[model samples]
Target: MLNSEFIATVEGDKVPRKYFDGRGMYIYVQPSGAKYWRLKYRYEGLEKTYAMGVYPRVSLEIAREKTEEAKQLLIQGIDPNEYKKNQGFEIVAREWFENKKDGWKSRHAQVVIDSLEKDVFPYLGARNLSAIRPPELLTIIRRIEKRGASRVAEKVLQRIRAIFRYGIQTGRAKNNPASELTGVIKTQKVQHRKALPIEELPAFIQDVKNYEGMTSTRNAILLMLLTFVRTDELRSATWDEINLEEKVWHIQGDRTKMERPHIVPLSHQAISLLKELPSYPSKGYLFEGRKAGHSISDKTMIHALYRMGYKNKATIHGFRGVASTVLNESRLYSVDVIERQLAHIDGNATRRAYNHAQYLPERETMMQWWADYLDEAQGINQVGIVGRLKGLFSR
Candidate 1:
């Protein structure tokens, strides 16, 4: 019943419109003589038909296959139109992605968006629901892997699978091609190296302050190292998020890794750094990127360090590692207090239930100590326009 030539060559037309030849498949004639195939069908006694795509682009044989597939779904008690819509899993997946991304950190949102655009959308963006195969998913991930972004490759696969699962629930995709792709690719384990000890911290700080970059970037990097918040939370930080008086930075939930708001009681030292930053040409983010609205590049700080000769030896993230190491080893604050100050959540009930911020006294002291360390390393006796910075302290 599904023939190629019959659907391919457009000939006799009884009307200027279109006509269903047989088996409920219609041949549509255009003003310019282009032909298109559509399948006419009914489900639950409701009349419905599906666009089989344009002729030549969707050949006669392909149209027939699509028609038969629709009929099969109808026979299976699923509305063919519904199934056809569901078949375009990518559309459903994208909708799902947007909905879930509301709480993702800004940096994460950008990365995920870039990954989907470059990898998934190109190969399978327009493919019908029934078309994507597991082998195809493997190939897509392998392509990302070949580019040396193995972690990103695996993450893209996970997001794609989430979309397929959504498609299955909505009756768009038949089976998850991504579901069968488990264990197909090997991902390198990410083990964060502990930061070099506080004992060696002064030496490290002196090394860093000597490096050169835009003053704002240098300040932002030092702040991140001191605060130990996630990369994104720091970069997307807004002026409104700070309270120099309260000595805290309330990172909004959307920018936090935990998908919950965090209150960072900034040490006097950190606040000093913020206060010393030049007034923004425009008002908004604390550290606005070169772009009007976006945050500064994550690499800016690391590059600063590299220029200062800490290349391959120190990292911006290492600041957190160092902070966690020193504070925890010193036992200056309870594990809970340090964890909370660190904006880290532990699985224990009490820790999770810790509603009030802790470690105020000790954190203030540690922050000062960290600042002193950096000053010592940089061989500077004073830090961040002391009186001017401290004046903004109470508010």
Candidate 2:
């Protein structure tokens, strides 16, 4: 019997070694310090070896389970290797997800797998990759559309296409049935997020100031309004990312929607709000959830808005739209500066490379002005930039 401690301590020698665990399963160690799990078996009077997987990745327990599964196949007069070669769609999709999930955010990866399990796998999962045709896949998509989830239906189709593409690259599939069905489904019209009109901004600000929820949740809404960064970027922010002396929030590339590093010029008001947060001086995430070591749930800010009576009238994301509208309407800042401050990606690749920090000074001024605008709306009565901007627009 092999224990994890013994396996962890095993070292390679000049010659390769095999440690058997009985029932034809063993760990093979190479001279190069590589360890692999293999199963030795006999089928039809011929000796064969199947490569289970590599260790620590494939632990001793999983290797034993594979051994039992192989024995069951042998009892039923089937070859485990043959079954693996002709694996069903579900198996291949899961393998593809594991291979590709490293590049995606955790939340997005979960959504992809959940969609496949809920709407895709029940019908087509057991079928062979090559056997599933366009019509059969369409039926499942139509079922989703019938339930008024046209957007989800479209996303499911896109995932199926990507899965089939992975299958072909891995030599597990010949043709992609989902490719031809792209435009066949009914897609819902694009609806922009609802933003409170500029006229209604003062009242919304008052409601948020008077919000009676968790103090952290209230601070989150205020931060989002001030920074206008993406919801995930703000909520998942760590204390180390903030440089109070530098007046900046350095968002790492992995956290941004554009997958590029972004610099936010924090306003005086934004800085004051940050100092008042419960986790301001903490070493971990800015907003700690009920679960230890995790950030607050994505629904926290939105649900806070609902409680404040802004159910369909506004959204957390809507704050970005409101800021853009107010800034563009104010005509006090350049388009490029406003866009860069908002972290909007530039369409031109060459220009985008150099534009992230191009307008730092102007952006600092604009961010401060925007923050002051919000403060004035909240009845703080700062009259420098906010007073001028207020005169430019009604209410």
Candidate 3:
């Protein structure tokens, strides 16, 4: 509704004043002689102002056009001011990342940034945060799935949802489009670590003994099988945690996945293996890596298994599964005793708190039985390994 003559004729005042152009549009004249085209409107009973442009640079006709466009947006129930404030996906996503990265581990934070840069930013980075619809995000995730990286796609989807949630909470976006994508991507099947079947244990044990890898890696594998502890726990084991006289290996809660302390009863075989391990007086690890003061890398064990021709057939972690299956099949121990030795969670909360040492006595017997079972399986005739004990056949 603004005219060029009236806009040009509008004089500066002592204070900023609006020269009405009719219907929520005006030319704001400042005391310093600067004029700006602005629109005033009510949205949800709250008054909001949107700046169209500056002075004659934005001619009366151009200002009128912008005002009409804003009116059309208002008619559609959109708040023009909010629409203008909503930033692009990349901008808002980086903001969200900055706010959240502090709480994440350094490696985890790096992975998230890499995922966003590689998978998300290239396609939809410049698009408005609120303007991107659900189907569009589905296309992005499906691109990752097409490469057979279903797990990466799932993680990318999670990151996208988190970014969208941040945008919504900050009032930059009205709704979460990613939420509409629930159940859209097919869940990837989880692949458990490969372990040998019980019947194949004897042959596998022979292959391990015949392996030509480093003695440290070999010891790691044997100790892992003997203790049935997690691979990382074995890799990071310190000498102080093991008491050769007590025949016990005590792992603290922080190192465990369940964040609970675990005690492993060492059999004579395990004790002999520990004694055979070469010592570094300066280092604390039971299995020290080639690098000074560091434990063995996970890849060392993995590649050792591959070189032993058990690449897909078995894993170091599979030893736990092998032990669990064989122990349960033997029926010489109770489920709680086996599970306690395995360091698995107890379902009952009250029991879990008090049951830290629940089956320690039975576990001692069960661990010795398991070690003897492994000795016989490997054709080793070590003394005390085959020594008979109390209630060998009782339920």
Candidate 4:
């Protein structure tokens, strides 16, 4: 047996030396006096040595504990070195995340990692992936559900399932415990965002035009209605993304939710609104925030809506819902065209890949019609204009 005093005072000779701590554990000392903790063990027939840690950092007690853990693995006919190489839940989860995160948006990637770190890692990080049974994982998930975060619990479960699948593919795990735990938690009811009714569009459009908020916020609201792009997409819009000459807003794949590039055909009215914006640097965001280089906060437009007395009646995301509802009900365009303009991903990967600019001419016409319809709704009374839109959407 070795004591801390013996370890601290041990000296190295011209040749490397091993001072035994009993039970196949020893401190290996180099000729230059560097020392490391190691375990000498046999599995089946072959002899093996596993490095525990360097001397001081891994004290005698800790080294002994590690040796005991390895011995326990040996008792179960498992190789300690092999388990260390491939069995940690946290290690496998992180590898899976790194392999897949490049295709995800930066914010979404952060969210995936954050969920694992905050919810899953602390409890199961060091456990062997193959050793975590269904009940064990369900216990952790149920803990999250008990905290009243059913949605987060569901997402964590899905992520855990993915990790185990990756583990199986990589030979780190034999079974996916999370797979059997699906639907064990309650599903949260889906609450759609509050969108103004089609009949209320005229009033809502009028109120937005008359909004006495910051000019930029008012413009942001109006543009959101006109384009119906997601809030983040609109807020983060750079001047470079808008091509005035081509009458298109080219959103790069990384900026979109679907991780595919999308093209928004600019309506005449939309281009006019762009022209009216306050002069900003060509390289900066169209809707710049108070911060030097960042776009407006996500809450900027929503807070402005709240200030306009539309709280609960309308939301920033609700604009997309409103657009989708009216456009689909009008039946003035094909479903494909409408969905493409909204940047909704097509389920067919082959079609989605080649359809970024599909129906460009029809989309242009539809967008212009949408803009013209909005103009009529905003009290721009053109004889028969209101009647035509009313009749078009009457169905």
Best by TM-score: 1
* Per-residue alpha-carbon lDDT of candidate 2 for residues 284-355, written as tens digits (9 for 90 to 100): 888888788778888999999999999999999989999998988888889998898788888999987776
Stretches of candidate 3 off by over 4 Å are: 1-86, 147-149, 188-194, 199-203, 213-304, 311-317, 336-395
Model 3, residue 220: distance off in Å is: 6.5
lDDT of 3 by residue, 180-206 (tens): 998878776876988886657777777
Better of 1 and 4 by TM-score: 1
Off by over 4 Å in 2: 1-81, 84-86, 104-119, 139-155, 184-186, 192-194, 197-200, 230-264, 271-300, 311-313, 340-361, 379-390
Please write out the lDDT profile of model 1 over residues 4-117, one tens digit for every residue: 666556564555557576798987887566777887777777777678888777776677778888788777898876655545656776787788788765555776777788
True-structure lDDT of candidate 3: 0.82
For model 4 the local lDDT of residue 265 reads 90
For residues 87-195, what per-residue lDDT tens digits would candidate 4 score against the true structure? 7899999999999998875655776898899988999998878667898888888899888788678778989999999999997777888989867988767878899
Residue range with the least summed lDDT across 10 consecutive positions in model 1: 385-394
True-structure lDDT of candidate 2: 0.85
* Better lDDT candidate (1, 2): 2
The segments of candidate 4 whose C-alpha lies over 4 angstroms from its true place after superposition are: 1-87, 102-108, 135-156, 184-187, 190-193, 197-203, 209-220, 229-263, 268-301, 324-331, 339-358, 379-395
State each model's CA lDDT, in order.
Answer: 0.71, 0.85, 0.82, 0.85
| Counted clashes in each candidate structure | 8, 0, 0, 0
